[model samples]
Target: MAAQGDKHKSISGLTPHEFITLNELEQIPEGFLAEHSANQMEYNDAKKKFAEICEDYGKILENGKKSQALEFAFKVIYDIEPEARSIKKVKQDKMWNFIFSSKGNDGESKRKICWIHTDKAVFKHSTNPKEIILTVKLASLLAIETWKMLIEHAQFMKIDKVLLTPSAGAIYSLKDIRFIAARIEGNQRNTTNIQKIINASCQPGGHLLAESNYSCALAAVLASTKDMKNEEVRVQIVSKVVKQYFVARKPLDVDKCRIWCQFAFDGNYRMLNNSDNDVLHKIFKYAQKNAQIIKLREVEF
Candidate 1:
């Protein structure tokens, strides 16, 4: 096995750190475990194929050396998707036209347009920069599902080969809450799948519905992405969440509550450049609402 931390450790006499993340393994998907388990036989076969490919290519000795075949073998055998691999981006050009009319058949039509292109093909017609941003936003709302599919694809080779960091698979690394929390903190874009998951967990009666917790958001994101659909293991997820919810008694004991606060109180203000005082004020308002609800409990006395 490739040595865990020491970059000097050898994989067939090659250091693993030359190609994989040193410690960011917690950002991967949860389905990796099941895929690894179900495909153990295939995984072993693929591992053998990978070793053969490495040996035949005479490239295993150079930890940084890479090729499609080698990459494919690692993806196939280990089911990891590294983001470092580069791929050609899709591109397109478009124009827009506008017309102002005051007379019949005699007015000249005015037009305004711009040409653009991008890496993702899902939004083929999104040529306007604003439109492209909107497309990404809308499409990203569907990220939970897309990410799930991506995770699954990495497992089965159902799609083209995906690159991966040799960081003990993606999901396993992401399980560390602190790491996910940091990603939330470091992200530049105001909106992201992680943010969405956090938001979902914070809404009233939302997946999280906690006052000062963080675990539910983590659990929800984990559960949602555990399979290709948030529904695959719905029963188990719900049961597990509900079980944990009641078992904790105090909402603070729930990890979900902390996840909510981390993003809500810390991530928004500290990471996203939002006004801390404003966010805190809003949070206080929400707290007052909760307090009001609790105050009404003694009316029958």
Candidate 2:
């Protein structure tokens, strides 16, 4: 979105495209927006329809109806966007949604987690739209594993004595939960290269910096935790995952763990280095057996 000349271009403005978050869309120039807005409108309409369907159903891409929906979502966003190298992009891929219950209900289960492989993170709250969080099929699996680890580590730290909430465990809307910045972060230290790669694939953050490149963008679950007094305490998703891992230190049922969302940011993420991708694929094989979920599927959302 830099104010460069109107001539330098690709099929779109940015190479690969943007996820077109609300912030990015707002930053677009009036002239550029009007020129390419029709296509954007079409996509927006499709997104709205998809949102409505997601509202009705508990999950998207259920029973393998993801092909059509994913095709539309995997475009170069708008054809006029530039290489976005100059414009910092902040995006979120809602791999899963939380169903909130106004009155607390004991029946609620833990919120589904969608872990993104962020380059940096903001564990606390900020109106900074540049706080980037993303995930892909591989990252989601890593996220689950990361969550398991979080609960484990956190138990050794604090929150082991915390009580469960009374509601059908709402994922506490983004506005209510306090995001802990990466101040006293877990070392994410690993002994082997594989462990290192997998560990890097997980995080939930504050004023996160962003670039429109391959950093494994994924967010499949809405993760959160509560205290005994039925109040939403500010716990990092990773830390809360840390606490939960101890409480529910069971193995993840890979078959039961499903992510219905596939947010491809203008095909740029596909440009991941082959070596990194190979390592990631191997890591995912150890967890998300449905690792091939990235390719187009018949999703219903």
Candidate 3:
């Protein structure tokens, strides 16, 4: 039984730090717990913080006032689709809905969104650097708008935590968005309210459960299960593991990136293609080969 369990752990390619039991979760810092705990009291506090922030945000929007950077961002998005004035506009648009629909039986939608948002340029006719920059900027603005809409919708429904399906650009912006929430009514000083704004990029195989643009739904389902806390621990663990891999001069190929995301988010690797599978296998093999050099330590939850 011990050998079988070890084999399964090896096959899963998960380090000891990657899994967190309920008891382990209890030992996490109070600050971490406040932001991440799904307990009713903590969750309600997060919701109240979010509502206060949204109220402040409403005043800003009402006054036609925005930071210079935000003004630029809004302009860029409007340039892409003049009609995309708000999240509701994009959500109701037929084309946007189609683009964000489920990826069929396989998890192709996740990959498709990644490629389209990261690699595909909007102005195919122009190869100018300025045009390419504009295209990327527009995509990022749309992603932020989508995120805002999701937050508002969640608040209306009284949902406490939100999971985001972020583009590469959007992923980088998550910390900023969370900070915005923290700034509300001095919520930043309160450790418990800090992690209320959790976000993650869409893993390679996440579409099986969430399709494409419905990451908030996935968050709701996860919040209902004990796996939510485990998922948070796994994300922290895998992020450190991937960073270590990069520090060792390992190149992050597309397949490797996919594998890293899947492992980080506790995704179903079986839903990925054979190429991704091969990369995951290689990752485990490499970890074993360099175990002595890497000196990985178990992370406390």
Candidate 4:
């Protein structure tokens, strides 16, 4: 097992710091508990596979090395659509184009984004130069930093469209809130299937209604059972946000000069600390009626 603050991943998939947060929570959500078990299994499986990889590559001992050049390289080059991994970006009249597109006319839509789904990798065309490149290690922590940058200016906020990218898999990493083998669409060109999922998630006008966004968003941040301490988990927000940003032309531009947003209020972090006890119960049950998947905008800005 990896040590508390070491680079290695603990069996619970959380960092030593996260364990402290885990201990602070009062209630643990059921969905988070399910995800915690999945994370442990994923960690064990990765350990075994990584061992085989090291043995095959003749670096078993170096597996403990501080630098993970091989490990990180494998993840970057191993994306679903390697072709989309690297490409030149261009900006048109006040809008950036997803030039690496594989199909007919490029499609675009705008929608509200949730706090959880805020990764620049999903906005391939508008990735902020300052945004850290996505890697398996940083996927879970990406959003925290994204929001943290703005937190100083605005201490409280609300979010719509919590799901940032389209993905499906069984593993639970902080990235889905993290996924094991899920085909995440955040880092690549939105595939046909992924776009379909996003399309289904929005109104004809291409906007996400919070009516369905809050329930899943609520379910995502709840803590795990018995101090499951999944490091992949981000902090939870219980109150309705005072302000939220709509994804304008460029969500987060490298120049930091290409985006505009409509806004709304103040809410802070909280620990519900109850079992299966919903965080915002009345609201959760109502959002379930909509049952929509969280999604991000991908239309011509």
The estimated TM-scores of all candidates read 0.22, 0.16, 0.23, 0.20
- Could you say which candidate leads in TM-score? 3
Scored against the true structure, residue 106 in model 2 reaches a CA lDDT of: 70
Off by over 4 Å in 2: 1-50, 53-69, 76-86, 89-301
Q: Is candidate 3 or candidate 4 better by lDDT?
A: 3
Which is the winner by TM-score between candidate 2 and candidate 4?
4
Residue 164 of model 3 has an lDDT of 40
Query: Which TM-score value belongs to model 4?
Result: 0.20
| Tens-place lDDT digits, model 2, residues 179-208 | 111111223232122122222222221001
RMSD of each: 22.2, 24.0, 22.0, 22.4
lDDT of 2: 0.23
Clashes of 2: 44
Q: Report the C-alpha displacement of residue 44, candidate 2, in angstroms.
A: 19
The weakest ten consecutive residues by lDDT in model 4 span 257-266
> What would the per-residue lDDT of candidate 1 be over residues 1-301, giving only the tens digit for each residue?
1112111211232122222332121111345333333333332333333233233222322334333323223322232112111211223222211111112255753222211111222233333322222122122222222222233333343322222223212322233334454544554322233433443342222322222123433333333333435443543443333323323232322333334334333233223123322322343343344432121111111
Candidate 3, residues 129-242, lDDT tens digits: the string is 111122232234333433344344445445444334332223323333344344333454332222222221232211111112222212222222324446566445443434
Task: In model 3, state the lDDT of residue 274.
Answer: 55
What is the C-alpha lDDT profile of model 4 across 100-171, one tens digit per residue?
Answer: 111124555322111111123321211332122222322222212221222121212221112222121111
Q: State the C-alpha lDDT per candidate.
A: 0.29, 0.23, 0.30, 0.23
* Model 1 deviation from the true structure expressed as Cα RMSD, one decimal place: 22.2
